[model samples]
Target: MNIRLNLVATTSLVALLSVSAASAQTMEELIEGAKAEGMLTTIALPHDWCGYGDIIASFKAKYPFLTVNELNPDAGSADELEAIRANKDNKGPQAPDVIDIGLSFGPQSKAEGLVQPYKVSVWDEIPDAVKDADGYYYGAYYGVMSFAVNTDLVDNVPTEWEDLLKPEYAGQVALAGDPRASNQAILGVLSAGMARGAAAGTASGEAGLQFFKELNAAGNFVPVIAKAGTLAQGTTPIMVMWDYNALAARDTLAGNPPVEVTVPTKGTLAGVYVQAISAYAPHPNAAKLWMEHIFSDEGQNGYVKGYCHTARFNTMVAQGKVPQDLLDALPPAEPYEKAYFPTVEEQDANKNAVVSGWDSVVGANVQ
Candidate 1:
């Protein structure tokens, strides 16, 4: 992910101009506007174990008047982008009211003018690095990239990026598809690069490309898989996965071959799940309402049940909501604090180069 401070200033200016042109309304007024419109909010999100269902349930409970429809494409970011691109011409019901996409794709969506801006009141609680300046997108939750090791397969678990390249672990390690293929997998490579002293945010940097090339040459690369259960059950000794998936897998692998998840001692990349309103949403009022509700205290707390990290730092700390044990399980937050999210310009300039690099260095090995 790329982070550019200038984009935030640009977005803020646009939002200020937008508000100046329209009459400002309070939160209650916005809710009333939403109710009067009888609008429906459509969402596009992944069907993975990222806690989308939990968020949906909360939204339904709060605004019974507003209708919420979801379309689970179960496709990669590129596929989702294509769907959004196709809808631009049709302007059909398939057009989303809101989109919950991976962080890496947030810039592409913003750059294409497919996203609308609406900053919530609690926006200040979120770090600037994880959010868009114009309110086009806000990260709802995040997962740190980490290694899941099957204790039964190897006596010693790898604690750093360099450890994965050991001769003994050759052909034993597995990664998510190329970063270009999956946002999470891309962060996995970027995190390893960061540990090697690469410049932050830019994906085409030497550290990132070289690190991926080595992982590929080691025969550790794996394409996206529908079922990771077998791997968690020891079918594969080691795999790169997000914190939630790793935790879920470990919970599932309780009896048989126990699995352990570690945020590498060297460092790890954190991928955020960002939410944005559609540029041409049918229910703008309801879409804004949905954003307000999700960032509210009640909604953010629900993530704790699924072991997902909420984006609002102050709220989490104020509620005393985070469990002590889970806090212990978390890697130090400093790295995440300094984490990056790409800007529209950086993404536009480097996306092709980065994708092509991954294709040559990593995708070639996967095939």
Candidate 2:
């Protein structure tokens, strides 16, 4: 179960043995170290994003000794990397111990030496395709892109990407984050391109940029970064974001103003977020413990409660670990039938295109 022991990369046998010996420490020892550290700093994790509010409470309840220091909850994936880089020389609270970032940022982070390698106890259970072979980072959870509509403000609900461009939807549509930096927003554009029948990769990215350009020109695109509050207030009637985020927002709003979450049948794109420990973490043990906890059965279920599909979903279902009620609580599976998970390489290419082209192509600065 402890794949990290076998995957240690070292030039000398002594170093390998040293890491193996350290990895052999019991969970109790890890707990003790984490308790001694007494704090774990995390960045870009909003409480509602993946039931992290409850999950963080659960961790606090279980490990009373450690305090979870949360940084900017709304920071984008690029912002997360910048935090690591900006604080590499400082071992203060501003320095994040861990990060939850987009899949495309995983390899880039590792390549830039921003993150350290540490596999959870259930390493083998995680799908190999979404995890680093050396354990620098691994998929945490994922959700499909969807439109969260404020029914009170939008009588004609948009069921498809193109439907949002109609004049009736003017001043209504918005993206969840800044496309120039946000993984979610960038991928949303990719989804729109895919919906337009463009092939995935750079082509789709370019297509998505053009679509947004037209959307901006049509006066249908709101420059505001939409969230639950903005949607409920009718500030942004239609938000393009991950299904999990839309679901969470819908739950939080409790039908006040009412909400409709729809995964466009033509352009459903599944985006995965990954987790990693900062290479210069001030609390390495606590960060590792956090990783272990998130990959655990209870932690994974917490994400399910927030509408996200955890990385170990298949394994948990096969082992009958997830609760039946939680599974039943999810939205209808039909809309996600054609959800597409882009390759890391493809995402990297698409992200480059979107980020570079967004300002000039879209001309809408999403706050």
Candidate 3:
């Protein structure tokens, strides 16, 4: 969904839908169905990203009858889709029942028949622009791209995309994931390109590749994927990742190395992550219950606690469902005011350009 709706407009939509009603399944019936199924498998959800660790734990505590199976927490969006495809015929722990993926992947996965349609009880609260008309996939939460710096190692934290090219930042900057396969990195490239004056679609994707090529040639781009541990160890002193992830990392680091998250003045790209049930999910009922739990006020607030703006964030705020403490914890709302939210077509075009050209254009071969 596009951020052009603005919070006020979205709140208005939520108000309009408040009296319209919600999904059909009752919580008790879903719980009973889930308990009979007894298991829920998921993939590519890391404890440190978007406060998912606590969310998962809460789900387990709330539904003690079901076993939560997690797989490859570090896998990227592409890997998640691959897991669904690889396990289409399998019904074991490797088979994921639910998926939290990049926006473009929602439609792509739905098109490939990897995901099935299922709307949550709070469906009415979600913005129409972000959710599928047929309920195939819906946004969960979103965050803008930002720089996570190890303050102990960096005297000057870059606040603009161009600042990363400065000589002082040599061998210090790194992307959070491999651009070829990771949606975050692919979008990271688009953000940088937008800063360099390229338009949003394929042009930005190509421009981003050239930008990274320069960074690599100048010895300022680290080929290794950057994360909390890598940032603390100084392997990647400047990590480019989602603001939520960077903030979570800062909290996780707890001042050991002094972490700082900064949203760049230019190319402030906002990325939305959506959720969907797997078409081949062995425990379909449990998956539906999991969706209901996450889309609930508690679940939306759970994401907010991790610094993500949930799909129902505006609605929850209007309803006074979000805690004051969580509101205070978020990064300044001013930067996000100018954050760009690309449409699915733009994202698909940019993703294709970045993925197909990364090796040929940038040649980093990031591990």
lDDT per residue for candidate 3 within 1-367, as digits (tens), equals 5432374321235423522322556778778888888999989899999989999999999999999999998888999999999999999989999998888888899778788777787788887767777777898989999999998999999999999999999999999999988899999999999999888889999999999999999999999999999999999999999999999999999999999889987888989888989889999889988898888888888999999988888777887889999999988887788888888788889999999999998999888
In the order shown, the candidates' Cα RMSDs to the true structure are 4.7, 4.1, 4.8
Clash counts per candidate, in order, are 3, 0, 0
TM-score of each model, paired residue for residue: 0.78, 0.94, 0.94
lDDT against the true structure, per candidate, is: 0.64, 0.88, 0.88
Q: Which stretches of candidate 3 lie over 4 Å from their true place?
A: 2-23
Worst 10 residues of 2 by lDDT: 1-10
Compose the digit string of candidate 2's lDDT tens values, residues 89-201: 99999999999999999999988888877778888888777898777889888888999999998998999999988999998999999998899999999999999998778
The C-alpha local distance difference test score for the whole of candidate 3 amounts to: 0.88
TM-score of 3: 0.94
